[model samples]
Target: MFKKVLIANRGEIALRVHRACKEMGISTVAIHSTADSNAMHVRMADESVCIGPPPAAQSYLSVPNIIAACEITGAEAIHPGYGFLSENANFVQIVQDHGIAFIGPTAEHIRLMGDKITAKDTMRKLGVPCVPGSDGAVPTLDEARKVAAEIGYPVIVKATAGGGGRGMKLARTEADIEAAFQTARAEAKAAFGNDEVYLEKYLDAPRHIEIQVFGDGRGKAVHLGERDCSLQRRHQKVLEEAPSPVIDAKTRARIGEICADAVARIDYAGAGTIEFLYEKGEFYFIEMNTRLQVEHPVTEAIYDVDLVQEQIRVAAGLPMSFTQRDLVPSGHAIECRINAESLPDFRPSPGRINTYYAPGGLGVRMDSAIYGGYAIPPYYDSLIGKLIVHARNRELALARLRRALSELVVDGVATTTPLFHALLDEPDIQAGRYDIHWLEGFLAREES
Candidate 1:
């Protein structure tokens, strides 16, 4: 076990890692920007350091600042809790070069999975199903156009290095492809510093299902099951649940085994997720997130696993105590991402919070860093908190989420709670029949 560790991100996740480390008897070093000088995570960790100013580029994303903080605090390892430097392969290498353990996968694994293009190829070779797409990155506009034609109409041009819906364009016709190709290339270059792009057959009513797997360096790995993240807005997931209501016993077993095998093949270490697009009962591998996912709590609730602690243990070279046979989901768990937004074409809402309250009771969990008098600086991600609920079944879980959302109170700034309430009342969501496009259409119907 590491004597001390550093958390290189902020908000609820930072606090989350703190609690986990405390239980493991490991001290923590919390790094915060100037804006988060007095945040809860900083106060909770045994030691805290101010990295930089409010801007993320100079603070949390600053590689030298993070490494310097680790060196100064004498931290043996660094735990990047999602976003910021979590998925950065170069960042991982930098930490390793300093003889500090990066509580994530090896740099090689990160590189292979971080690039959307290379990941798709690996999935294809590993016998995991993937959508039909270009064999590799298209270097020229002409090459992109040719690949788009090969994949047929209604294909998506995506950055080989992008995630979270950035650097992506949808083209359904020759004219659309002609107009969007260069813009996508330039946007990809700017956002990800890579002009490389690829084409994929876009599935129309796809449900995003992802399997969570953890690998240790000792040639052992296991799957904790899957999560249904199909309910998305603007290609970003808004709601997620565990043991997707759609997957059957046989399919789940097959997917779990295949995902574990894929990770083993790469000799991947640390926790990762293999996301797939499921439409009409067929699963097509989409991409892999090389770090802990944002919606990870839902899986933890159902599986009764402490993923944060597991991440630290993996970093310490401890083999998993359980295997595939020990895998079993107890009940239904659902998560609603409470983004700072206004309803109907929601946009980012960042400001000082005046009143803040979270629900309490069994079966409900709230993960947040904002509180009364907490200022939500506009220099970073829009997520404010995650409202999670667990129950004996999906129906009860939905009802519990409704009550929890209603109980949650935040003043002085708008939130997406209203939209979440409206969504919970939808027939498709009620039936667990919703897809990514369901939220938009439901909102349109509500407005009508």
Candidate 2:
């Protein structure tokens, strides 16, 4: 067990990790930016350090400042929580170099899974089903056309280095492929500093499902079921749920084995997620997230596992007591990302929260650091909190989710709460019969 741990991120996740360390009888050192000087995570940790000013470049994302804080505190390990340096391989290596452990996957595994193309290839090599695409980058327009032709049109040109749906274009025909290929390549270079691109047969109307995996830096790994991250906008997940309504028993079991095998093949450690695209009774691997996820709470809720604690134990080189048999989804759980933004326009809405209230009960869980008079910072992510709920069935879970959301009240600033309100009311959503683009299209129809 670690004597002390440093949290290298802020907000609810930081607070979550701090709580886990406390339970394990480990001390916590929180590193915060000037903008988060009064954040809840800071107030909760055993000790806090101000790394830099408001901007992330000088604070949260700054490797030197964070490592310096760890050195000063004599913290034995670091829990990145999520975002920021959570997925940065170099940061993990730096922590290891400083004689401190990174409470996640090894630096090698992180680097291997960081690149979208390489990760996909590795997954395929491990016998995990992957979206049929080029093995490497499509550097030329002719190569893009050839790949698209092989994949049989309606293919997507995607940036090889990074993907947020920014440098992607759909080509349905020969003429479309040439023009779209040029644009996707140019945009890929501008967005990711890499003009490399790849082609894949676009699976329209697919449900985005991901398997949450935990491993002990060895060959031992198991999955905590799957999360339906189908509700997305601009390739960003807005709502997620565990025990996906779309995947069945056989499919889920197969996916779990595939994910465990994928990570084990890479000799991955700690917690990670293998994202998949499911369409027309088939699943295709998209990529892997080499860090803890914001939607991890849904898996925790149903599986009855504390992912942060597991991450810490794994970092200490402890063997996992839980196995494939131990992972049993007890109930349905859902998470809605309450972001500081507006609908239809997706603009940032940062202002002082004049009033705030969070829901609580048998199954409602809210992960947040904001309170009354807390100003939503313009320098960070827009997510203010997550409203998670669990129940015996999806219908009951949805009802509970609605009640929790209804009980949530934050005044003085516009929020995307209304979006969830409208989303939960949709029949398709309640019936769990929608695809990834379902919510956005539902919103569009309402606007029309």
Candidate 3:
């Protein structure tokens, strides 16, 4: 096992990795920007390094500074928790070239799964189902039009390198095709520096379901069920739940095995998520995240495993502690991503936290880095914490979430806590009858 590992991110995820390393008897080196000088993870780590200024480009995303920190601290590995350089294939290769371990998949897999078009082609070859549309990039407006006609109306034009709803547009009818095609290409070029775009048969009211798979890079892998991330706003997941209320045992097992086998065939290492859009009892591959996801805790809660520790173990050349048969999922888990944002407008709410209190109990967990008097800098994402709750069933889990949310308090700054409260009262959310577009439509109704 590695004696020390450097965490190359910030906020709650950085703290999450630190706690995992500590439990595994591995020291940690926390890298922070000037803005995070007093961050919780930096304060708790055995060693610390200041990378650069508040801007992510000069700090969290700076490869040289991160590598230098590893060298200075004698850290043997780097655990990129979710964002920043976690999915950057070039950064992974650079770390490997420097002889430092990256606690994730191989650079080859990262690069392969990073591009949407390539990822879809790869999954299709592996026998995974995909949304039928373009065979490859539609390089011309005429080609886009041709593909749209072939796929029929209500097609979606997506950037080959897009995410977070950016560089994406939908054409519900033939009349909307030209606008969607041109706008998607422009947005793709602006956001990802790639004008390449692809087409997909748009599925109305599909659920966003993802399977969590872990591999040892030695032809061994296992699936830990699925998470229903249907509650989304603007294509960003807002809430997530494990043991999807809509998926039965047979459906879960079928999809889970397919994902596990697919990754094992590629000899993928560490943690990865294969996302899909499910509708009418069929699953269509959307994309693959080459690193740990933001909603990993829900999976962990249901399976009773520490994913970060497992990432470290596999990276250290150790065999996985369990096999597929050993993964016995229990109960239900839900995670609410608490962000520093105001209601209605959802604007950024960054400032000093005057009074902070986390809910506690047998089945509730609050993963956060902020404390009283800590200033939330506006230079990063608005997410400040994740409130997770687990129970014997989905109904109890929802009840527990409500109870926990009431006890939680964060003063001197607004949060999205109220949003979750309102969601809990809705019958669709309570009965798990929501689709990917449910939240957006609900919010729109509220606005009207």
Candidate 4:
């Protein structure tokens, strides 16, 4: 086990890692930017260092600064919670070269799954079902037309290196193919600096379901369960739930085993998630996240496991403490991302918080770094916290989340709390009958 660990990120996730380390009898060093000099995580850490200015590239994303901080504090490992350098292959390689452990998967796996086209090919080869389309990059409009004809229309073009809904386009007819293809290529080049694009048959109303898998790096792996992240806005997940209301025991067991088998086959280590789009009892591979996800709390709440601690143990060359038989979800869990953004418009709301109070009650867990007086900087993501609740069943879980959201208060800045409140009242959301596009359509209806 590592004696001391350095956290190379900020906000709620950084605090989450710190708490995990403390519980494991490990000391933590918090690296922050000048903007976060008075952040909550820094105050709670055993050691704190200011790496650079408020800009993320110069601070949280600066590899040299992170390395310098780890060296100065003598941290044996670096825990990059979620974003920044967490899944960066180069960062992992550099940290490993310096004899410092990275609490994540191997760099080779990261590189392999980082590109969308390569990831799809690999998953297909592993017997993981994928949307039928071009085997590789389209390369030409003529080739894309042929693929469209073979796979049927309504195909989507996606950037190999893109995410967050960027560098993607849909062509529903033959006439739209050329324009869509060219636009996707241009957007891909502008966003990822790589014009490489691929096509896949676009499912109209697929649910975004992802399976969580953990590997010991030695050929052993297990799947915890699935997370229903279909509640999304502009392709970004807004809310997540565990033990998806749609999946049955048989489907769950089959998909979980497939994901675990794939992870073990690749010798993957630590925490990873294999995302899929499910529709009409069919699952199609979407992508893979090689690091901890923002919605991990819901899974933990239902599974009763500390994923961060498990990740650390895996990094230390320890086998997973539990077998597949021991991993069974007991209840329902829901997570609401509390972002510093206004409702309807969804504009960023970053300012000094005059009043802040998080909800607390049975089965309620709030993970946040912002306080009453903290000034939220506009340099990063708008997410300020996550509100998670667990119960014996999905109905009770939804009721708990509603109560918790009502009790929560954050004044002096707009937030997405109102949006969640509205969602809780929707018939589709109440019945768990939503897809990846449902939330967007609902929001659009509200605007109209």
In terms of lDDT, model 1 sits at: 0.89
Ranking by TM-score: 3, 4, 2, 1
Candidate 1 residue spans exceeding 4 A from truth? none
Q: CA lDDT, every prediction? A: 0.89, 0.88, 0.96, 0.94
Off by over 4 Å in 3: none
Question: What's the CA error at residue 283 for candidate 4, in Å?
Answer: 0.4
- Candidate 3's displacement at residue 168, Å, is 0.5
* Candidate 3 lDDT tens digits, 319-401: 99989999999999999999999999899999999999999998999999999999999999999999999999999999999
At residue 257, candidate 3 shows an lDDT of 95
Could you give candidate 1's per-residue lDDT for residues 60-125 as a string of tens digits? Answer: 999999999999999999999999889888999989999999998988888898888889998889
Model 4's alpha-carbon lDDT is 0.94
Q: Which rank order by lDDT, best down to worst? A: 3, 4, 1, 2
Q: What lDDT score is found at residue 423 in candidate 1?
A: 80
Q: On residues 302-336, what C-alpha lDDT tens digit does candidate 4 reach at each position?
A: 88999999999999988888899988889899999
Model 2 vs. true fold: TM: 0.97
The predicted structure with the larger TM-score, 2 or 3, is: 3
Candidate 2 displacement at residue 21 in angstroms:
1.2
Write model 2 residue lDDT over 276-389, tens digit each, in one string.
899988889988888899999999999999999999998898888698898888989999999989766879999999999999998999998889999888999998899899
Off by over 4 Å in 2: none
- Rate residue 305 of model 3 by lDDT: 96
